[model samples]
Target: MSQFKVAAVQAAPSFLDVAAGITRAVAFIEEAAQKGAKLVVFPETWLPGYPNHIWLGPVAWQMQFVGRYFENSIEAGDVHDKAIAKAARDNSIQVSLGLSERAGGSLYIAQWHYDETGELIKRRRKLKPTHVERTVFGEGDGSDLVVKDTAIGRIGQLSCWEHLQPLSKYAMYAQDEQIHCAAWPNLKLYEGGAYALGHQVNNAASMLYAVEGGCFVIAACALVSKEQQDILCEGDPQKEALCPVGGGYTRIYAPDGQSIGADLADTEEGLVMADIDLSMIAYAKAAADPAGHYSRPDVTRLMLNSKPQRPVMAFDETAGLAMEAAEGAAAEADVVEIASAAE
Candidate 1:
C-alpha cells in the first residue's frame, strides 16, 4: 500500500534463549498487528541477543557467553524461524526481523523479511560485521545487498553500522527502496567514553538515511536490561562503566528527515509506531534524487558485485564421462565390424 502504519521494535531479547526470544517476538508481532501496523521492524540480533560482552571483556574471558550464544542463534528456515513467519501470517502483518544467522559452524548478522502471507521474501546478511563482531560473525557478500518489491512497497534493510557505509546506502537508494529497516543494538552502552556510538550519533545516522534515500526509515534499537548488565559486568566496576544499561533509542523518520513517531524512555521497552506515505518520497526525491536526475553518474558510479561468494565450487565431470562412453561405443562397433568381416 502507498500509505500505512509501521512499528519499530525497541526491546531487549531473551538473551541467549532462542525459544524464549521467539515467543516474545511472536507476541510483539501479534500486538503490532492488533494495533493496525502493516509492518514491524526489529532491532539488530534481537534473537539470541547482541553480544555486547565482546566489547566489554577480553575474548578469552568472554568465551563464557560464546558457546551459549552460538547454540541459541536461529537458522534460516528452521522450526524457530517458521514460528515467527507463522505469527506474521496468522496476524497478516509484514515483518522485518533481525537476528544472528547460523549456518553450519559460523554465524552472520542477518535480517529476514516476511510478507503478509508469511512467505519469506528476502533474507540478507550484513556485508561486513563491525569491530569485535568479527570474532563471532562472518561477513556477507554483495548478494546479501538487495531490495525487494512486495504488496506493501519496496523493502530493504541493513543492520547497525551497515547504514554507516556510504556506498551501501547509495546502492539501496539506487534501487529505489521505499521502506528501510535500520536495525541497531543498544547505543548507550559506552556512551560515557565512546561518543560516536551514542544515541545522538546513531539516531542522526538514521535520520540522514531517510533524507538521503527519500525513504521511510524505521530505526529500531534494543534496550539493555539489568539482567544483561549483571551477566556481562559480573559485579565489576570497570566492566560496568564500559557497557552500562539503557540504550533503547527507537524512532521512525519520514522521507523529509523529520521524526514521525513518539519518543520512548531510553530504558523502557516498547514499539514506536508511525504512519508513512510513499507519496512523500516523490517530492523529496524531486528536489534531489542522488541516484537519479540530480546525480552526475558520468563522473562517478558504484560497481556493485551482487554475486554469491561461495567458498568452494564443484566442477562438472559430465563432459569427460560422455567422452569415455563414446569411446567405448566406437570400440565395440569396430570389434563387431571386424567379426563380421572375418566371418
Candidate 2:
C-alpha cells in the first residue's frame, strides 16, 4: 500500500502483570483497529513493563523486583504471546509489540511483530542492552536485525537505544524498509536536574532514523504513572528523583523527518495516529538515501552476519551413533588392510 494510517501507543504497562498488560494491550489494539489503523506500535517493554527499578536502585536494592519481573515476562508461543496474537487476529490489524521476553532463566528486551492474521512475522531482541539495561536483559544477534515485507510495507524495528547504532540503522535502510518502529522507554526529567535525559534527544533519534532511512517512523514511548514511580521508589528517598512521572512523548515522523499528526500530551495515555503516504519516501530518498547513492561502499562497508544465535544445537542421536559406528568400521578395515600388507 502506498498510503495508510498507523498508530503509536503511549501508555504505561500494567506494572509487572503479564495478564493485565495483555488485556490492556489488546484493548489498545482493538481501539486502534476501530480508528482504522493498519498497523499499531507499542512502547519499549510494554508487556509486563520496563525495568525502571534497575535505573532507580542499586543491584542489591533492585533484587526485590527481579523475580516478579521474570515471572511476568512472556515466552514465545506461550499464553501471553498467544493472547497478543489473538488480539491482532481478532482485530484484523497488524501489531508491533515491545515486551520483556523470558527464556530459561534469562530475560531479554524483545519486540514482536504480528501480521494481520496474527501470525508472528518478526521477533527481535535488543542487540546490546543499553547501560543499566544490561542488568536485566540479554543481547540480541545479527538475525534480529531484519525487515519483513508485509501487507503494510517493508516493516522493520529497533529497540530503545538501537537507534544510536549507525551501522544497525544503515542495515535497515539497506533493506528498503518503509516502516520503522522506534521503541523507547518513558523519556522524563525526574528531578529537573542538569543531568537528566532530555526528551529532545530521544525525539531527535527517531526523526533522524526516518530521515536517514527514508521511511515512516512510528516512535512509541511509554508513560510513567505516579503510582508506578511510587512503587519503584517506595523506600529510597532518591527514588523520588529517579522515577518521576510524565515522560511520554510518542510521535510519528515522515520520511523527510517531519513530525506527523497531533502530538499527544506527555502524561496522557492514548494512541498517536498518522496517515502516511509511502511515496513520500521517494522524495526523501532523492534528497539523501544513506544506504543508496548517498553512500560510499568502497570507503566503508558493513559485514552483517544474520545467523541466529543459539546456545545449543540438537542432532539426531540415532543417526549420529550410526555414523560413528560406520566410521569405526572403516577405520578397522583400514587397519586390517595395513596389517595384511605388513604380513
Candidate 3:
C-alpha cells in the first residue's frame, strides 16, 4: 500500500465572484501543500457560490429574481481553467474542486481535477442536481461520472446529494475508485422550518457508505454565514428559505468507516488532513467487494451504452440537389402565376 496525505478543504465561497473564489481556493491549496498534502479537495460548487436560494420552497409570483441569480454564475473556459491549473502547478499538488460549469448555454454542477503539473486531468458533472437545483443546472450523463487513474491512485468524485444514490455509488465502486471526493454545501435552515436533521444524517450516511465500499472519502463542505445569506436574499425574505447560516460538517473517513479527520468548530475556513494508504483497499475489498466477490452476476448485470444525438437543420446536406429541384419548381410556379395573371 502506497501512503499519501490528503486534505479536505472546508471554506466559504464568495457569492457570484469567480475570481475571488479561485483566489481563496488557491490559498487553501497552498496551505494544504505546506502541510505535506499531495492532493486537496474542496466543497461542491465553491466557485461562483452555491445558489442555496432556489431550495427555499416556491418563489412568489412577484419575485422573478431567481432567474437573475443564475445569470451571475461563471463559465468554464480559459479564465478559470488557467487560474486553477496554475494553482496546482505552482503548489505541485493534485487538486479537485467543485464549481458551476457553464457548457454551451446551460449550467452543470461540475468537479474538475488538476495534476501536479497543473494540467487538467478529468471533469465529472454531477449525475443529478438535488430538488430545486434542477431549475438551475442540467443533468449529467454517465460519461462524465468516472474515476481517473492518477499518481495518487484511482481518484473519483461525486457532488453533494449524488452520494445518496445507490446506483451512482455502485458505478464508482465498480470502477475501483480508491479515493472518492464528495462535495457539499453547508446545510441551512428551510423557510417552512428550522435546520433539517435529514441533511446531516444523509451526509454521515454517505461517508459511511464510501468506507463500506472500501474507499478513502474526502468530504468537503461549505461554511455559510448569516451575513452571506442576507446578501444573497436581500430583496425577498422568502429567499431565506434557501440556506440558513452556520452548518459546516466537513470530514474525512477511512475505508473502515472511521472518522480520520474533521472540523470541530465548523465555523471558520480550515482543512482536515488524513494519511491514506492504498494497501488498505485490498484488505477492505477482501472482506467484501460489491463488484468483485459476493455477487450474483449470473442473475443480472448492469450495462451502460450511450449514443450521441446531433441536431439537424434543413440547409446542412451533402450537395444541394434538393435545392436545385426546389429552385426549378419555384421558377415554373412563378411563370404559371404570371401567365394566370395575364389571362
Candidate 4:
C-alpha cells in the first residue's frame, strides 16, 4: 500500500476478434509499463468488444452478430487469457483486464486480475448487466462481487452501470478496497439527451465512487471507433446519430475525488498514467470513512451471500456407488423378507 503509478486504458478492441484484441491489449500493457506503471486497467468487455449494437437498434437486429460475438468471447484460462497474463508478467506489472467471458452457453462481463509476476489472482463478473446489456450477457452471482488483496493493494472492480448500484459499491467498500477499477463501455449517447449516461456523467459517477469509498479510482473507458459504429449500425439509417464515434474518456481519480492525471480525450486511444500515493487514502478517510466510523451497523448493514450459484451440481463416482450399494441392500432385504413370509 505505498505510492505507485497506475494506468487506465481507453482503446478500441478488434471488434469480434479476441485474438486481435489480445495482441492490441498486450501492446498497450507494454507501452504503459514502459511509462513506469505498477498497475494497469482496461475498459469493460475490452476483449472482442462491447456489444454496441445492443444500444443501436432492435434486439432482433442485434441478433445478427451474436454468433460472431459468442465465437470470439473468451473463457477463463483460454489462450487469450494466458496471453494477457503473460503480457503482465513480461512487463512486471499487475493488470486488471475486462472481457466478455463465455461460460457454457452464456456470456458474462468479467474482470480478471494478474499479479506483477503474471499470475492469475482473482476473477469477478458483473453482478448485473444494464438495460440492453442483459440481452447479451448473463448475471453474475454474489461471489462475483468481491475485492482481492494484491501486491498493489486491496483491488476491486465493478463493470459499467454497476457503479450506480449503491449496494454493490458499498459491498466493495466494506471489503476495504484501496484501489477500485471502474470498467465502462464507451459512454456515447444517441443524441446526448441523457447526459447522465454520457461520458461526463459516467466520469462523475466514478469520481463520486472514489470519494465515497476513499479509494483510488481507475476509470477505464472503452473507445467506440467510427469503423465499429459503421459495422454495428450498418442496416440502420440512424447510425450516425445512434452510434456516434469517439467516446473514450479514461481518467484516474484520487481518494478525494480529484483527477490524479490529465484526463484522456473522449476520442483518444491510449493509457492514462498517474502516480497514486496510498497514504492519501488516510486523509480522505479521516473526514468520512463509509465503512469505518461513518457507518451505522446498529441501524443498517450490508449482507453478501458470496455463493457460486449454478443450475446443477455434479456428484462424484464414489457418491454414485454409495447410492447404488444402499439401493441393492434394500432390494436384497425386501427379497429376504418375502421369502421368509412365504416359508
lDDT of each: 0.89, 0.87, 0.75, 0.85
Give the per-residue Cα lDDT of candidate 4 at 109. 94
Best by lDDT: 1
The runs of at least 3 residues in candidate 2 whose Cα sits more than 4 Å from the true structure, single-residue gaps closed, are 189-191, 194-196, 235-237, 316-343
Error of 1 at 237 (Å): 2.0
TM-score of every prediction relative to native: 0.92, 0.91, 0.83, 0.90
Q: Could you tell me which 10 consecutive residues in candidate 4 have the lowest summed lDDT?
A: 334-343
Better of 1 and 3 by lDDT: 1
Where's the lowest-lDDT run of ten residues in candidate 3? 334-343
Candidate 2 structure quality by residue, lDDT tens digits, 26-111? 99999999999999999999988888888776799899999999999999989889988999999999999999999899999999
Over 205-312, each residue of candidate 4 has an lDDT whose tens digit, in order, gives 999999999999999999888778778877466776877788888989999999977777788888888999999888998898877788766666666666566678
Per-residue lDDT, model 4, residue 319, is 98
User: Model 3, range 1-343, lDDT digits (tens) per residue?
Assistant: 2898999887778777777777888899899999999999988888877876665545663146445445545565657678888989999999998888877678889899999999888877887888778878887776665789988799888888787787667767777789998888876546246434335675686567666679989888887866667776674655755565666778888888777885546677788898888898888888877766745566545444222122333554755778868756754543311011112
Candidate 2 residue pairs that clash = none
Q: What is residue 176's positional error in candidate 1, in angstroms?
A: 0.5
Q: Arrange candidates by lDDT, highest first: which order?
A: 1, 2, 4, 3
Please provide, for model 1 over 159-241, each residue's C-alpha lDDT reduced to its tens digit, 9 standing for 90 to 100: 99998999888888888899999999999878778899999999999999999999999999998888988888999989888
- Where does candidate 4 stray beyond 4 Å? 235-237, 316-343
